[model samples]
Target: MLRGQAKGMATLFGQMLPAESSQGAEKAVQWAEVAGRLQSIWTEFQVEQLSKASGEKSHYTDPVKWIATFEAVMRQLPLSNPQVQQGLWDEVIAVLTAVLGQYGMGPRAFEEAKGDPHMPLRDRRFADPEWRSKPIFAVLHQLYLLLSTQVMKHAEAIEDLEPGRKAQLIFAAKTIVDALSPANFPLTNPVALAKANETGGESLIRGFEHMLDDLRKGQLTHTNPAAFKLGENIAVTPGKVVHETDLFQIIQYTPTTDKVLATPLVIFPPWINRFYILDLNAKKSFVRWAVEQGLTVFMVSWKSADASMADLLWDDYIQAQIDAIDHVRERLKVPAVHTIGYCVAGTTLAATLAVLARKGEADKVASATFFTAQVDFEGAGDLKVFVDDQQIETIGQLSPEGYVDGRYLAATFNILRGNDLIWNYVEKNYLKGEEYPAFDLLHWNGDVTNLPARWHRDYLRDLYRDNRLVVADSLSACGVPIDLHRITTPAYVQAGREDHIAPPSSVWKFTHYLSGPQTFLLAGSGHIAGVVNPPSSGKYQYWTNDESPDTLEEFVAGAKEHPGSWWPHWVEWIRALGSDEVSARGKRRPGGRGDKVIEDAPGRYVMTR
Candidate 1:
């Protein structure tokens, strides 16, 4: 299956080449050179390994060790080139001169700390008493930064390299430097050393115990599970489960206002996570805020896929959403319903809308709001690096149970932001023997859900790898062709400025694909924080442009900055779409089509382990 997919990808790449003869030939030659160089590099790496194994002091024969050694050397190969070495030496000399000039300039020269919020490693080793007051360590840190900068510059200067290859090279260099940082070692990391001294080595003992507990549980220690209960402290919004299916449950949130909008709102959250992300707490819940705004809201609580659900496919999810939408329309007795989709759900919703458009029933949706969703995966960011042929093939072979394990997905995401999600936890929980914080967000992050093998495979292929969703007739769902251009519903799209998962530029491209009047919001935080932002927080700001530009760069340039949350902006947009004020329903009604109430809000599906 993976080999076929790979061949298709090659075909797509070939088709993407410029139609012009000269340009096409030049690109072909560049691709050929890259392929040849990669092969040669691998060959040299194998030869070096064999040579090392035959030495007087033989290298470790472990396959894992060999692979790690090869990867490390490959990352440094570019730096070893004569041209790159020259550039790096020049940068080193310049940094040294700067450091020397600062020597006699008083305490101010040495006062600047190595740690910057942008640089994670600066805080580790440099924070130790031995290094903190020493000017030499500071100079060494600056020189390291200079070397990294120069290496990146060199990588970027490689002419005609594919964007993917360039990105990989830059990331590889970064990973190597991060791994080799002095801060990771116990002797060099002052914080770790001080903790050991203060605790008389108790911290290490406790850390060892924590590691054992985590291993036994088959997961990382991310949050204090005892600190939260689903229906109490976390998913506490008042609601009732009006319906249930094999795939999901529909929760009808009780209105907080005296009157509600005539057009009800329905939400489809990404199944990769629990639904409570939007309803994390009373203070942070978007669901609660919407309810207070007099919008009668209903949310789909997706079942955590297990062995029984391993056969579920993408079509199954889309159909379930369609069924939920129909149920909402009937239950609320509204001809049309407003819809919101978050993350993967947003992608699925877009596809469903296209299916609706094909069936001449697009009017069923009053309006569509997409939160950090991507239809065009062209600039999908670093996550793309892990979705290539070899990786996908490996996953396919391993997931014989017909589901991708949630733990693997969690680990991959954690690695993407290792400084915050992985290493910070390592330094605190393992080194410092600190307990994991009882933060609600981290708790939700740890509560992962499996993706059915078929669904996961198809999604990565059709969307991320094939780029089929944006291309008309290239993909289909629910037995109908999918195309974003066909959907005419007015859209409210939000993207995070600092979101590595779905870059703002990629999210902004949604405006270009949708034919309707689209409003693009650029939030100031990342994927989760940006969307969960409430006005009361007064934390992150957002940007908006009435005149949606053709390009993301232009939109950003001309956009007006707004203080606080984008919730009010979304509320106004939904209001403008013409939801009438009406008396709020006091009690839960039976779900549409005689579907019986299964349980209360934060229902069984959501509570699935």
Candidate 2:
């Protein structure tokens, strides 16, 4: 019997066989169809949509656009160089023939099985000899299936997808090849045929495969899980105690008047992703540098959401962060504190500052920092497409109850880079008999968490869909306008250069609209690595300037040169803004100098949603 997902694929092959090979094609159709459906559905629903939806903007590939893209891909593909393209085509035809021939079938066998019960009713996989293996359905279905498995197994970057919806994406190649009319592609040109054949095969296997690989190695997942292993002064350094919480967390690095005076340090990390990216394994963490430099650092550790805590929203984050700032002031009694925001948290922090500025509380915000945060949604990139009214409505419908299911967020991340996260694992671990390395980062990626649906829905609509923060619209929770110009605070914006989710173009916008003493630093590496960067990593590279440039573009042009760690620079900047005072230290709880401080590294309050 054929696998449930492979029915359509079996039929397509059945149509490829000749009358004489009908029996053979019939025998294989059932099996192949199962594989086909899995791939097709995966692409249609998951890969395409999620990628299109990752940003505030959406980009689509129409049939003509796809054909052009294929031609372009063909133009640049290494396969075209010195017969590599022809070589790939030969390998492709061989693989298809062998896979189908195992059941007494050939390309013609599928044609012969058209009338049979199991085989697809089509004449062949494609009308073209080059595309004789399978139709759009079979090819995409397989691609998606492979991509799905790759992301599921290898991805450590995604924190935005759901399980059930993971099965709905499709990556269709029909439009890409269908545009090759004999006029554009001559049958005589082995190069053209080879290009088509090579591209089709490579794209099916590699695009999704590469996508999965990207996600697996990416930090979104790796950062969360690996930290649990370090018990004490772990080798990796950024783990600094910021605030000793009620749960007995050492709070890493405690703030001191001396620490706050010298540098502008505000730690902002995504609520979905952990805050420790800035404080990951000791040697690589920024928190460690702040402690050494006598600069106080305040990092926000957002708890993972669960069924019990789904009512949290953007406002909750804004308020919690403000409370944290207040707590810092009361303890250390500093007049103001520097703020840093990352990913969504970065956007939230920016909004918080804006709100403060608008409400005449700007004095409380001495400075602000944004780490890969998004403000404007107008051209925010591919993230917008997924939230088309339909998905937004769907998610909103589910949000009234509180938390957005973590599975759903996981699915989104998986879909964003389906090829890497899904197909790569399928090939490497399942088919290739390869073993994944036992990397701590990989372990961290496996750690999944959930978001409240209501909060997420509001976020998508207000921040992304509406562009309320950047556009200066009325986004008041309890009667407060978020004005950027009102913010006279010294500002610094840092971003991960290779961040696909939050690109440089979008992040640079922070310097454009906000009226403040601002500096933008393009950090080295992807999102998480960029933020968690420690000086030990061969000295991190950053694009920054403090010349007081007028615009983001100019700032990038006149940025200063620095080879050492950015942590010291950040620490110095923050410390310069404060005064040296022992009174800033956390009070002796009830006992004496030997009194117990936070009992753990990251406290329980930080872990709770």
Best by lDDT: 1
For all candidates, what are the clash counts? 1, 115
Model 2: residues with Cα > 4 Å off, grouped in runs: 1-266, 396-401, 545-565, 579-598, 605-609
The candidate that achieves the highest TM-score relative to the unseen native structure: 1
How much does candidate 2 score in TM-score?
Answer: 0.60
**Candidate 1, poorest ten consecutive residues by summed lDDT:** 1-10
> Which residue runs does candidate 1 get wrong by more than 4 Å?
1-76, 82-130, 133-154, 586-596
- Number of clashing pairs, model 2? 115
Query: Model 2: how far is 277 from its true place, Å?
Result: 2.0
Q: lDDT tens string, model 1, 414-487? A: 86876678766766776566777789999999898887887888888878988888999888778988888998
lDDT of candidate 2 over 1-609, digit per residue (tens): 111212332344444455467565554554344346446645564565576524221113135654554565344334335575465456556544543443356546666653333222222222333333344333432233333333333222233545222222211222223222221222222222244233322222332333344343332232223345543333234333445432112243554233234323446567675555555555666666665555555555566766666666677777766777776666555677677777787787777887777777778877777777778766565465455566788675444457664545655665456545543443333222233555554544454556777788888888776778765546764367676555667877777767877877788777777776666787777666777666677656777775777655676689766764565566556656664534334431211254344444555544543
Q: Which 10-residue window of candidate 2 scores lowest in summed lDDT?
A: 163-172
